[model samples]
Target: MTGAPTPVSPQQIPAAYQQALRLQNAGQLQQAAQIYAAILRTRPLAEPCFQLGLISARTGRRAEAATWFRRALEIKPRQIEIWTALIDVLDGPERAKAMAEAQRLGLIPSDKSAAAMRKALAELETGDPRKADRLYRKALEAGGDPVPLRETWARALFDRTETDAALKVLAEGLAKAPADPRLLLTRASLLETAGRIDEAEADLLAVLDARPYHPLAWLALMRARKQPPGAPHVATLEQRLPEAAADPEATRYMSFALAKALEDQKRDAEVFAHLDRANTMTRRKFPWNFEADHGFLRDAIAAWTPRTRGQSGAAPIFVTGLPRSGTTLVETILAAHPQVAAGGEAAVMTPLLHPAVEAWFSKGTDYDAQAIGQAYVAGMARKLGAASRDCRTTDKSISTYATMGYALDTLPDARFVVLERDRRDVGLSIYKNLFRDGTHRYSNDLTDIARQIRLFDAAVAAWRKRIPDAIHIVDYEALTADPEPHVRALLDFCGLPWDPACLTPERTERQVHTLSSVQVRQPINRGSVGAWKRFEGALQPLIAALDATRYDFG
Candidate 1:
């Protein structure tokens, strides 16, 4: 077919293969595939064939992927990676045969250290950091290569809210491979959380300098700083879109990045266009379970017992509210106080509530309140580590509304700061961003987002009647408009001394790993107070579904 393939140079092929890998990793799948195919045309390279198989398998073309992988195996019969790819794309007898052959050829690493390292990573995914740490120690003791798993291990530590420990892990990783893109990106994220934006920017820039088209790095950089008009990144992001279409992950990152870039240039229409497409895809993939969530809230409220806070190690201050309703903002303000630890999105309660909800809903049984309080206190203290000592931990867990009344008995000494915002503004913010953590299905649809707000309102109203003294209502609009008096009152309610530092939450170095991370990094301002007015007509469906009152939506 091509006059002996023009006698392609073997040396030229490996460089092309690497360039294809960089493109694939960056999520530029279409371009990556073109190069891979071109390389295959010249030489039937096992690497390109295997990569193409992987791409096909990931995109759900399993049969085609299997064919490509088999073709790759024909070139290098004992190629372990090719066999692995074939196994994943095959089913029934073929998969079993492939698996057996792969094992026979040592496809899966069976060594103790390798197995331990693998389990350590899996444990991290399942949120068992203790188990992961144990496994990691086993791997290290067995002399496994730590460099490969360093980024993941550091992220696990960060997930536990052990920021210092996470940074220490990154330091060790960077010491070994200072220019490792993955480690640098991870450390950059950590540094950003630590309020070292300049350092984070430096790390991101270095990564980009090495691999200019990395989508995730571009997304991270986009969030860290403004993408001004005529900036090289703006055009690069735009041009990368057609190529990124085949990789949905790449498409999502580039879409959001480009949207942010356009917004920086005041291209409102284009910004919304990109957000709409990206959020639509996100909603499709991560649909929120609205009914189960609200059902739990209702049951928890119905099954509420009039109990007070227990004598706790450190009094828990829960900043409860809807997403994008200034919950993190309030927590940052409170965390500025010397005696408060910033516990962003405390997840300790999530597991406890699910079973509690099921028991209450189906069996009319109540979860043990005293045990919940004790467990929450102990777990939260462990999560915050040294910061929990003599400090009131401000846990801005967004779903605390579901169990605030239950906490009256379970978490008796816990102070609840009920943060409220204008429904319209909340709607706008939630619609524009993809919530990576929130299993909030309601956020996918405009009407559902509106309905959820009213549910939150009703829940808070019920809590106010039951536990008014324990609840401190903070109106986000009023607080942002005039912060000093509200912050003083907020601190007084939690029995904390007034630190003027709370007045400037932007200066607070608390880690905010949420959609509002970038916005909350700035000083409190009324800029977002009524920003919804700018898009009123486009958001009419959301407005109509709010069951609007002049007081509520206006």
Candidate 2:
């Protein structure tokens, strides 16, 4: 309809297929889909259907494409390539049905290849990643060339937090498929997470060279350079990011890369521009609204509020804000106090009160106010490893306090420290950090990152207005510029007597699973405060927007 839907003949079909692939590669997804659909409508060919299914999955219409693929397989049953498409399209129940159908017709070999895949899928669905890892490994042992199986096995292990094993698997795969972009990228991610930034750079650069438009690879390369234990590669990344951003997949990552680079250079405005582009791309690609868990917060508050009547221990000091916001610094300082044992960013509250939250939100069920409070105290004792009877106070710090009201409502006795930093700095740090997907995708662009930060800021502000004395706002700049005084004030707020040991934060031995792992080890500095100023000219739009919103942390 648009471009005279290229007429197909047997002679012209191959060229049409190649042209369709080129369109798909260039992010002309709708055009490519039309071509593939045209090719399949008349012929019902396995190749076209498989290609169409892949395009559909990538474009987020996997279910509809899966139907066409099933129809194609009905005609030509033994296409190995179709199996890959099949796996991409099928989910939990659909996957089992597809695998069984594949086996019954001898599409997959009778011995365990089909069964193993089903087992792995089941294990993954049931929330048993370790079992899925073992099943994927077993699938490889039973014969097929081991490329896909090994790749997925590594992912399963990585999901289970068995990083060393995951790295080993990815390393073995990379050795065999040196030029394979997926293998190279996976290894790069594993290395990056382990703080092997220099090594990760090599893999990411290789991936970019092979598939220069791969955005994740570009972003990874950007991050690997920015916080290198070695040298910064900002110039190289700057040259390459535009090229990557020209492609859709790489564009989101480029947004973040640009933001981080600008932030590192103290060009806050440029950082925001990059972040805005990233958010726009993300919304275009995957549009959805996420409702805040306020009802959950409300129920939690109702449960805990009654228990705090005329009763208090040095209450659980909640250290919360955006992920990279010096939450660990707050915890480390408090942990140094004789009274506080750090319950490092545990899932205690969510797990304990999640059901009550769901019930209240879904059915308006009444919840026991006192039991909710008592349950949380017990949950903290269990997770904090504090003796229930001997505990005077235990500090529980979960960065989820970006939702301050919900937390305050649930645990009214709980003290809160709302960490604050310049939005550009916070966003830049987030983009540079390797978060394990989900909400971390917000940091993939300056606009989305800015929006999320604004949302959190707005939420916190509203909460503070409602309960002004309930929370303490901690500015990262203040903490960095005057560490001792701020630390003393924070300790005093948490009702802990400050120790001189709290000042030498590096001396405290604790696992900080954040991008600032290296930064926190250094003595406090004013380095990050004005870091976004360097790219001021390029970042004017973002600066104007910030001014318009009046989000000045200064």
Candidate 3:
């Protein structure tokens, strides 16, 4: 041998481990993560632990990063850099304590307000926006201009679905600093989510005017309007590509924006190229954990074994499917009925389901299926009472697909209206869009996305077989092509009286928070029925992967 390897690459390091390091250096974090995880399964190494922490940090998984760093520390307690990395991702008193220890190792300047800001961010991420609001206000009160925190605070509120409040926060910031691009962009997002597309476009344009070709602003612009084939923005996006090279994240957004612009122009090859670059960046940022979700399905199926359906009426209807399927459209249709309140893509069920069936087999938490169901119904009835006097509701949370068994058993009257679309279309939609960071982890890679769809179909098929009567199929193709019959059938299955309102779901008066928000506003059309054919050349790999699934949607 020439010489022994370094500490991180000791002699006889696994070939996989070396490959992971090379991939990590090349910015292929997701692939590196796969290799690192596999290596850990076979053998434990502190270096992989540290690398994982760094990877998690880059992906914005603070808690996960801290966990990996701590594991690294456990293996090699005196690694100063590992301690520093751990401190970087910690929050609140934990961060403070870690910093206090790191101080012993070296001199590092501490930002006095960072702890409070971190604590506030923790509150927002965990869904305690009120606490975050208070923390931000407290930070502003103490001293200094709190303008920097304004965008962050507004984002927290927006994430919690407090659209009006979030906008108000941004408006307040804009009042003081009228030309702040960050505030303008944040406001644009708020307007978009609130279904004020024109207003959002105006804000986005303002942001782009102040900071030309701003990457995220460009993406927002695409969503806000339909561009013609040689739109001015397309040329601007192309000419300014080199200017955005400094920020990889920004570059990714620019690619997505360019892709959208090219797509409108029907430049399929160019669209595919940009999408590949943007989606590759997304995968690096947040690697998908296929085994984790796979395990959830396996465990969930085991925990909630097959059972017959128990029935009720005009109860909560959960419209669910893979993202980009017709979940939003179905919910919009159901909401058109005066009796239904559309709770668009909300996580209300997450908290409720966890107490009932989340890892209960391992933890042995005592749960009452019927009582939980009763509680969920009562809670939803009260929750949607303001939206509808009858308190009938539609919950289109994607999690509905995963937790249908527990939900159906618990909510005696609840119905599941699942959308069935061609998996290729779903995969194409997922790959083409920029979803929220944590929303669709597998979306960046088409092969991974194909696997996700296959597994999703498996789960849905299982659920359908178990409780066929309780779950209704809304075929996306058929509904979009000839909507009236399907809409009537959907309404009928959900135990609602047919009304003319159901025929025009696009006219719904409910807050829609999905990528299809703009699409759903248009009259029901068959435009996207086989839109995946447009990308046949670009999507051959994904197509081949999916073709193996042997699936054809109803």
The local lDDT score (0 to 100) that residue 224 gets in candidate 1 is 82
lDDT of each: 0.76, 0.63, 0.76
Judged by lDDT against the true structure, how good is candidate 3? 0.76
Q: By TM-score, who's the top model here?
A: 1
Residue 306 lDDT, candidate 3, scale 0-100:
42
Query: How many angstroms is residue 219 displaced in model 3 relative to the true structure, after the best TM-score fit?
Result: 1.4
Question: Which wins on lDDT, candidate 1 or candidate 2?
Answer: 1
The sequence of per-residue lDDT tens digits that candidate 2 reaches over residues 1-554 is 25545446654554566577678878898888788767654455566676677776776788877876777677656555576578667899888877666555444544676579669856764546677767877776676455556666676555445678888887787787778777788777666655566788898888877865566776766655443322345666667665542234455677677666665565554566666666655654443343343333444334332223322343567777876777877776766665666666666666655665566546777566456666667666644342324543434344345334445555666788888888766765664554544545555544555656765666567567656777898899888888998988887777677688888766665544455654655566776776555645544544554556523111
Clashing pairs in model 1, backbone N/Cα/C closer than 3 A: 288-440, 288-441, 307-408, 308-412, 309-412, 309-413
Candidate 2 TM-score, true structure as reference: 0.61
Q: Higher-TM-score candidate among 2 and 3?
A: 3
What digit string (tens of lDDT, one per residue) describes model 3 on residues 1-554?
A: 12332233322344566578779989999878877776565556677889999999998999999999988888866567788788889889999988776544332323544466677766665546678777777655544445556766776566545677878878887898898777788788778877798898898888888878577898888877678987887788888775655345567898988888888888887788889988987887689998878877767766776433433443788988998888888898888988777777657777877655665755767566666666655555444444545657788888788778778776667789988999888889889999987668999998989988988898898788777888999899999889899988998898889899888877775666677878888889888878899998888889988878633222
Instruction: Rate residue 184 of model 3 by lDDT.
Output: 85
Per-model TM-score versus the true fold: 0.76, 0.61, 0.74
- Candidate 2 lDDT score relative to the true structure: 0.63
